[model samples]
Target: MRTTKTLAPLALAPILALALAACQDRTDDAEDPQSASTSEADAAEEDEEEPAPVSILRPDIEPPELPDLPEVPLEPLDLTIGFPEGGMELDEEAKATLEQVLESEQVATGAPIVLRSHTDSEGSDTGNMRASEKRGELVKAWLVENGIAADRIRVIPFGEQNPVAPNALPDGSPNEAGRARNRRVEVAVVPVPEETVPDDPADASAEDAD
Candidate 1:
């Protein structure tokens, strides 16, 4: 019985020692500033590392309004008709070109046709003018014969005054090619202006009655 009692005290001694050691460790952890700071820092880092909640909603947006662009005016019909060297007569090529011109919408619409004739600088001013006039006359006659009204045609002879190319080269030599290009007629079909009528027909009638 004494031996049993002594063994029980020995077992109790080991259990008490373990409990004391556990208490000491808890006390040391509470007392240490570095341990407490490290625990707090770990908790703060965990909170900081957590991702924020995201929204699935999209923002409403609109495209900006654009301004209206102005209308562009149509250009007049303009073309050049070349003539043979020292000839006021129309050849097959010239006739074909005139046929094409006659087929144009401007010609069909009865647009006023202006024929401005030009000549090379080989002849005198008076002779060149006369030649240009004759050239213009021949083209006018052809147009008139092809059902175009004579009143709608206007002929303006420029002779050698308005040349498209130089009559002579830089070295004072006659430029035959340039002179050839210079001898031609410029045909322009001008657009007729629209007659402005009163917006209100009744008002126009009233004014006429007055």
Candidate 2:
């Protein structure tokens, strides 16, 4: 009986040790739950507090407006007068044509007209130059006699230096027809600019009073 009582105490010692270890493990598990929950909550809060990234694209810019310009006057008329064959005098048809051109609305309004005369390569350069000048002066005189203002006309004489026809004739001789064709006058009218016109005196006075 004494031996059995000592063996019973030895067996109870192992069971008590096991029970203590089990209690320690359960305590650690219970403590870990709260710590894990706190960590998860912290992660969620950080996600909610963060801002989204912005774009790098910019808005389009607009162009500025341009200012308006003042208007210019209308263009003038052009008139071509051919001289007679082998003659320096103005023909009847050419004179009539000149009269008609001068009577037009553009020339009547005192618009500036430029008269350029040319001669063929038939004559010497010096003679042709003189002829061109004479033709231009004659036309100017005719316009003046027909009531056109002298100030509104300008004359330029370009002799054989500028030929409309080639120097070679059909028969291989210097063609007089080409020379005659070159010996002509061209009239060009140029309109005045709107800005050059004088302002009304009444409008200026009214603005000053204001």
Q: Candidate 2: where is the Cα deviation over 4 Å?
A: 1-73, 196-210
Q: Tens digit of lDDT per residue, candidate 2, span 7-46?
A: 9999999999999999999999887888889999999999
Candidate 1 structure quality by residue, lDDT tens digits, 1-210: 999998998889989999999999999987899977989999999999999987665556555689888545336888878885658778787788888889887777667999999999987999999989989988999999998999999999998999988999999999999998988888899766556889999999999999
Candidate 1: where is the Cα deviation over 4 Å? 1-74, 199-202, 205-210
Clashes of 2: 0
Model 1: worst 10 consecutive residues (lDDT sum): 55-64
Q: Model 1: clashing residue pairs?
A: none
Global lDDT scores for all candidate models: 0.87, 0.82
Model 2: lowest-lDDT 10 consecutive positions:
190-199
Q: What is residue 116's positional error in candidate 2, in angstroms? A: 0.4
> Which residue pairs show backbone clashes in model 2?
none
Candidate with maximal lDDT: 1
